[model samples]
Each structure stands twice: as C-alpha cells, then as structure tokens.
Target: MPEEMKTLVVTGLRTQFNTAKGPVAAVRDVNLKVARGEIVGLVGESGSGKSVTGLSIMGLIDAPGEITAGAILLNGEDLRKASPKRLRELRGDRIAMIFQDPMMTLNPVLRIDTQMIEAIRVHDHKVGRQEARERCRDALGLVGIPSPEERLEAYPHEFSGGMRQRVAIAIAMLNRPDIIIADEPTTALDVTIQSQILAQMQKLCRDTGTALIWITHDLTVVAGLTDRVYVMYAGDVVEEAPVEDLLDRPIHPYTDGLIRSIPSHNAPGQPLNQIPGITPALDRMPAGCRFHPRCPRRTDACLEEIALRSFGPAREARCIHPLVEG
Candidate 1:
C-alpha cells in the first residue's frame, strides 16, 4: 500500500508494565496498517494484548505501563515521539477511541447533546454551539438513534444499554476523525443490536473514509465486519491475512483453534469445542512459541524461536507447524 493511503501505521510496538516482580511485556513486536475506509480486526482471547494495542495506538497507556519501543505513525507523523499536549490535541480531532463500556465515553450528569457539543468545540474551537449541536444530531441519526433531537436532550441515564452504546459511537463519530480504534464497542449489546451497530460502523467508514481498527476476541464478529484480520497470542500477533482467507483457510494452529471454538461450527447437542490450556502468564511465558503448550500440532521444531513468515499473497503466520501450507 502507498504511504499516502495509510492513515495509521504501527511497527515493532512493545508495551510493558513495571511490576514488583519486574517488567511484564503486555504487547510485543506488533505491526499494523490501516488504510482509509478500511476495517481491520485485531483478534485474540481476553489477555491477547488486543486492548493494549488499541490503547498504545491512542497513547492511553498510564504510568505503570509504558510503550518501550516502536513507532506509531499517523499520516506519516510519528505519534510516539509527539508531546503530551500534541497528543491531546490530536485525540478527538484526528483520532478517536470507542471503549467497550458506554459509560467510559458518557458522563451520567451531562445531557447527551451537551457532552457531544463539548467534545466538538474542545478540538475545533471555531465550531459554534448550534453547529456542534446539529453535528451531534446528525451523528446520532447516523448511528440509528430515534428522534435524535429529543434523545440529545436526555441524560445518559435515560437510555438503554444499546442506546447508550449508540450515543457513545455517535460521540466518536462527531469529529470525523481519520482513525478510530474501537475496543469491542458492541460486546455488551445483544446479538441483534451488535449486528446493527456493526453495519452502521461499516457504512460510516465507507461514507467518511475513516480507517478503523476493531479490537475483539470474538472471531464471529470480525468474520463479516473486517476486511483483514490479525490474530494475537501471548502479546504477539500470530497471524495476519485477509478476513475471508483467514476464516476459510487459517494457517496458524492458534487461529484454527479459535475458529473451531465458535459455537455455530459444532452440532447443537455436542460439547462446544475449546482451545486446550489457558494463556501463559507474561512473566512465566514459555521460552519458544508462546502457544506451544496448547497447540495440538506442536513438534520439536516449535521449541525454537519463531518469526512471522510470509505465505501466499498478504498472509503471514508465526509458527513452525502451521495447519496449512501456502
């Protein structure tokens, strides 16, 4: 991809947290590229560093945790090297993040319109209050909220869970940012609401040409929502491929296990499939392949250090014993 089309490029990212025992590496050697109007899925289990990657990109890692290495480039500007003040300026204007919990984005005491208008004026002081309110109404409508004008006047407590999530999404879209990192924004909603939000998000990206990195552990969610998929395990990305290709012909053992575990893939009465063994603790992680202990295809060669090797077009996997050969 040309550098001009790439809105967000992350390379060799390593984020660690300083603990009483020592530094725990929560993210390692992570590389991602997102182009305008593209939706990329960052998939993994609960502790797969998916959220950390999103936070790292947004420069949200707090004191105990620090980004130790690598570059985060936004339209060719290195964000990792940017000052705190610059980061704050860019956050709601050029880049935005939608957290899992709607409460994270909404203030209970404030009216929806007030909060959204404040968000807009904070970054672009030139926007008049009435103009910002109009933008907020449009955003709410775009997310499929009903009677956006009245909804805007309501407080955060007035809406249901799904409606609150939609309002949160509306706030994220208020600025028309170049990049949006959504950390499982629809995870808490029902399946039907989740589907609706996913469709709206894709449409918003298409209409506005915003690049989105969707962070989620549910493979089913990304199977249809994302264009490309990256699978992470034990702080490392284990596989990268186009969404269809990855779901249809997964190369890494870990990727295959994730697909197999999806409930729809099994018979109704059969015990749901599951990946064996829990992810290893960061400090006590296995020396070689972090997934070897749980991988059914592991061999002696897997005991050696592995690197992400390229396969067929736009595919890569970090494994010595991939389930499929390119």
Candidate 2:
C-alpha cells in the first residue's frame, strides 16, 4: 500500500519501564502499519509487550514507562515529537483506543450519553450539544445497541459487561477516528459476545473507513478478523505476513508454536499443544533470540543475535533458521 493509505505507522519503537534494577524494555524494535479500513492483528502470549506498543502509539505511556525510541506516525504526523497538548487534542479526535476493560473508557458516575457526548465535544468544541448527543445515539446504534436513546440515559453500571464494552466501542467511534487501537477489547466477554463484537467492529471499519490494530493473544480471532498479522514474542515482533500466509506457513518457530497451540488444530482427546516454556521476564530476557530457550528448532546459531529477515513482500521473520522458505 502507498504511504497515503496508511493511517498509522510505527517504526523502531522501544518502550521501557524504569524498574528497581534498571530500565527494562517492554516493547522493542516494533514496526507496524495499518492502512485505512485495515485490521491488523498484533498477536502473542501474555507479557509479549502488545499492550505497551498500543500505549506507546497512543502517547499514553506515563512516567517510569517512556517511549525511549520510535517514530509513531498517524497519517504522516510524527506523534513521538508531538507536544502533550497536541497529543491530547489528537487522541480522541484522530486516534482512539478501546481498552480490555470498559471501565478504562467509562466513568462510573456518568450516564452513557454524558460520557459519549463529552468524548465528542471535547475534541470538537464547534459541535453543538444536540449534535453531539445525536452522534452518540447513532454511534451506539452503529454498534448494535438497542434503544440507544433510552440506553444512553443509563449509567455504566446499568449495562451488562458486554453492553458496557459496546458503549465503550460507541464512545471510541463517536468522533470517527482515523485509527482505533483495540487492546483485547473483547477478551473479557463470553465467546458469543466476543464474536458479535468482532463482527460489529469489522462492519464499523468497513462503513467508516477506520483502520484498527487489534492487540490480542488469540490466533483464532486473528484468523477470522485481520487482513495481516504481526506475531510477537517477548518484546520483539518475530513475524509479519498476510493473515492467511502466516497461519498456513509460519516462518518463525514462535509463530508456528502459537498457531499449533490453537485448540481447533488438535484432534479430539489429544493433549493441548503449547509452547514449551514460559515467556521470559523483561529484566531476565535471554540473550540473542528471546524465544531460543523454548524453541524446538533452537541451535547454536540462535545464540547469536538475529534481525528480522525479509522473505518477500510484507513477509518477515526474525530467525536464522526459519521453518519455511520464501
């Protein structure tokens, strides 16, 4: 895709947290791009730095956790160099984030309408209160909320967990942002609710031409939802390809393990397949390839530092001995 088509682009991103020992990197050398109306999956196991990457792009990393190095471009705007005031102004207006917990987006005391309307008008003061309320209603309706006008009057607590998440999605869409980074937004919902939300998100993106970066550990979700996938291990993105290509022929050992671990891939009554070892702690991360310790394909060659190697267009794996050929 051309540069103009990309709504968000992140390059050489390194986010670190100041720990008791020293500064430990949570996200390292991450590069991602999401074009208009595209859904890209950032997939990995827990503690893989997916959330930190999302936070870094949104300029939400606070004290003790700073973006040490990166160029976060939103429609060509350099977010890393942007001032705090500019970031605040851009957050909800041009880019938004849907967190796993709806509470992160909602205020307990406020009614849904109040929150959603405020979310809109805060970015666009020129919009009338009535217009904002109408937009909120439409946004709620867009996300499949029933009786949106009446539902808007209810507090966050009045809605069920799924409903609250829907409201959160509604709020994120209020301003029709160019990009929305969803950090496991449906992880807490039931399987059925999760599917529903995923479908809704797809339709919303298609309708509004809004790009989305869905940060999740679920390969199942990625198979069904994303156009392309980036597989992360520890803090590094080990693989990147179109969703089908990655799932069908993963290059990195870690990416292959993740795909095999999906329940549907195993026969009935068989032991659930899983990656051999636990993710390394940030401070205690292994030298060279972070996943070498647990990798079935590990060799002495893996002990040496390896960088992401390109196979073909949009295909990359950070491994010396990849599982498949170009």
Which one wins on lDDT? 1
TM-score of each: 0.97, 0.98
Residues 15-102, candidate 2, lDDT per residue (tens digit)?
A: 9999889999999999998999999999987889999999999998998998889799899999989999999999998999999999
The digit string of per-residue lDDT tens for model 1 on 1-326 reads 78666999899999999999999999999999998889999998878899999999999999899999999999999999999999999998899999999999999999998899999999988999999899999999999999999988999999999999899888888889999999999888999999999999999999999989999998888988999999999999999999999999999989998898888998998998899889998889898899999989988888888999998888999988887887
Candidate 2 C-alpha error for residue 261, in Å: 1.6
**What is the Cα root-mean-square deviation between model 1 and the actual structure?**
1.1
Model 1 bad stretches (over 4 Å): none
Q: Could you give the C-alpha RMSD of every candidate to the true structure, in order shown?
A: 1.1, 1.0
Error of 1 at 196 (Å): 1.5
In angstroms, the error of model 1 at 46 is 1.2
Global CA lDDT of candidate 2, please? 0.91
lDDT of model 2, residue 164: 95
lDDT (Cα atoms) of all candidates against the true structure? 0.92, 0.91
